[model samples]
Target chain A: MSLAEVAKNPAGTGQKLKLQHLGMVYGQDAESVPVLEDINLDVSDGEFVCIVGPSGCGKSTLLNVMAGFLPATAGTVTIDGEVVTGPDPRRILVFQERGVFPWLTVEGNIGFGLSKLTREERRQRIAHYVQAVRLQGFEHVYPSDLSGGMKQRLQVARALAVNPDILYLDEPFGALDFVTRVIMRGELHRIWQTERRTILFVTHDIDEAVQLADRVVVLSSRPARIQDILTIDIPHPRNISSPRYLQLRDDFFFWRNPVAGRDSSGPSSQQQPCWRYGISPFSGRPPRSFRRRLA
Target chain B: MKLPARFRPVLFIVLLLVGWQVAIDRHPAQILPGPIAVASGIVDLLRHGILFKYIVASLFRVTWGFSLAALLGIPLGLMLGWFQRGEMAFYPLIQIFRPISPLAWIPIAILWFGVGDSAAIFLIFVGCFFPMLLIAMTAVRNIPSIYINAGRNFGLSSSEFVTRVLYPAVIPQLLVGLRITLGIAWLVVVAAEMISVNSGLGFLIVDARNAGNRYDLVVAGMVIIGIIGLLLDLAMRSLENVKSFHWSSSEE
Candidate 1:
């Protein structure tokens, strides 16, 4: 989704986040390890994109590069025609709940980046976000006092309170239990629909990717490269048990070439529980998607 | 007999006094005064206004010296922990001086300040300074990296980061350092007063023995010192128990 295409296409005029030939390498000389190679991605404004891969697949490294926390070894990440050299207040990265300041209360965390605002303005903004995140009564409570779900919500409120144009979340809900995680996904989707800020969310869960993303980007193993990008055209208020949703979910398992010679149709004994649970537990082989919704 | 917690200490003291009286019966009065004699000595000093004056004098020196040390040491430590170059330049110097007892500084303090309250206060300051510096430095260094990153991400400038994040983060550990340094400062001041000053608990003990072998007055001076040190420690303990500091206490 290039800026030119977005501009020519009257339906979308919002700013596009562009990444060209992004490459990142760690260490030096022989010890130098490549984390990302020949990566190119374009995210249109107001879109929710999820990058999904196995645990050690450098998905987070890619996010850090895009967030301007780590520099790309080779490439330029530009937004609205300006190259990103460092982290800007316009694009905030909401780290795992660990990033929330334990020393601060919910109100304090929300108001942390609002130093530019007047006292009255900061107060109103903080109160609005605290209530928006369903933390109205926990204003004076510290992160340590909050539960996992509440803390993640507090982090979201803190990030959203800053009013950034783009949000980069790194496995934000990975620490929550299954039920809480499912609930949080709905809350995030609701918040995203209401806020309409461009979000690039990183997660390893296939179900999570399918549920929340407008486009789910699949990446190959170490020194990750985009293997496929699948567009989820399903409307919101999505039903997980609905045939279309289950088809898309199961499609990921088929797309992910599970153990080379095995038949893709029947669920093997090892995969039966995962299929029952609706979350593939195994790190199936990297997916090969025939449907490249966006190139 | 059963006693309330508050009365238990009083009962224990009464027993201690009775034991002291019996122990002193085997010795001459000049060698070890009985508890009754020490009580009379305390009353005489109080009536003459000598005990209160000496206490006030000692407290004045301690306050000045401890305040001076705290004012200087904490900032120096904060900088040392924050900047690698500062640690490189000053940490070795701190390590070298920390082990040398403040008693060793007494001769130099007298030579520099010339044998009065200045000499005693200098000794107290030296005793208090190193602990404050080291503890504060460690406290600053121990603040989790996540806090620092969060602070910066919020667009806090370098100075704001130090003042807003670093200071509050280091406070709980720093408070413990303050209480310990004060105890050392009080201990050092007394030793300093015994050698160079004219009026303090230390001076009272020396003067009682020198003027007329008043063992009872010397014993009374010792008792006062113990009680005062205990009180100061209790005050600091209360500060550590405050709600904001409770989080750090759990780590210990």
Candidate 2:
């Protein structure tokens, strides 16, 4: 269904978050730079949506606008038919870097939003989340003592502790190594499955987007607008080497760079996909061999 | 060949004492007392009980002055940092007054407080206040916006934000500031005592010099001051090793 059709019905019907004609501009008038333009999207309850675009394409800006950290220059964001005027605890934005409080222990970070609960209740809640995130043994350890993946998990645990209806993640695993990033993706998927919270994740890695998101929203470069929205029909725990996965991944590449896709489809395509050669399609530069072939 | 790191400081001190003894071997004790003469003078003051009284007087002034500055300056700084208009309005005044040495305030302090513990304390207060204020202000300004956003997203009330987020975020930086400002307070107290109060270590130095050229006692007062300053710094440095503050230093 179209986004406009989804917005016509208020969020209480089925939609978790509704954005209509969302636009963001930094500065005023003549000197103003438009960062995001004419963005319309709707996420259903318990759905996972990933936004992917080139670097500096204002994907983070869109997430920030939705999270109510920045007011949209135009249009509105509504959750469950309520207009989001400012940041609310019900919708938590997990930042890109290690957002877990450095000064707080793992337990303390999880219990941060639970100040209203009684002491015993808070302790139990903290313990529950610590176990949920597999940080049980490191309850008293601070974020600095944690590895990159552990810190991100702590951040996710902190967000989950508040029982937010929606979680907005901005390139959360962008800093992790390749192995850790894959591991964190699986961990996040497992947590989301159990928690069933609506997640809007923004990333540049198409592989990550396909692996984690139910619907991937592609954005143009600066002054970002939706380029395409592809739905992944595959089930959870998808085998990366499966033909369906490869087809979808290659389709995403071709959609982004049709000319390059056509060039690679010549006799050289019989070899192997560039991804198998450890080349990143999202890196904005093709492999040397591919470049040589094109030349 | 290579000394252990812990003993290096001790070795340096021993060499310093040897150099001092050699430099002063040909001079009369009245001209410049050697370390041995200063040691005897310290023992003599200890026997007379005057050294204890002087040290206590100096410490009492510093405690009052530094405590008052911290209590008042920290909150003021947090407010100024949190509120942009307040900072823009008052920061210029702080900058203008900061460069004036605490010693320069001596005459005015004496006039206001009438040449006693109060005058010495007032000068120390002036010495310590600005550094604390600036440090607290800078600490508040430097807190990562992510932390503030996180705190607000969790629906922290204004008071809760200050108590939980702002206060804890500023602590590691503030502790370092406090240590430096405390050193400044110590230095100002001695100077203030020399001119106004007649009952501190600073007074002992001036008094010893004037009364029959007791150079040994003057050197002894200097030694005591140095030792006390070192101890105060060591105490403050220990606070930095606290587990909660380990996040501020990346080495952890």
Clashing pairs in 1: none
TM-score of each: 0.82, 0.90
Q: Model 2: per-residue lDDT, tens digit, A112-223?
A: 9999999999999899889888987999888888898888889888899999999999999999999999999999999988998889999888799989987888787778
* Residue range with the least summed lDDT across 10 consecutive positions in model 2 chain B: B243-252
Using alpha carbons, what is the TM-score of model 1?
0.82
What stretches of model 2 exceed 4 Å from their correct place? A1-13, A256-295, B1-5, B27-31, B250-252
Poorest stretch of ten by lDDT in candidate 1 chain B: B243-252
The residue-by-residue lDDT of candidate 1 on B42-66, one tens digit each, is 9999999999999999999999899
**Candidate 2 chain A weakest ten by summed lDDT:** A266-275
Identify the CAPRI category of the predicted complex in candidate 2.
medium
**Model 1 bad stretches (over 4 Å):** A1-15, A27-34, A56-59, A219-224, A247-295, B1-38, B212-215, B241-252
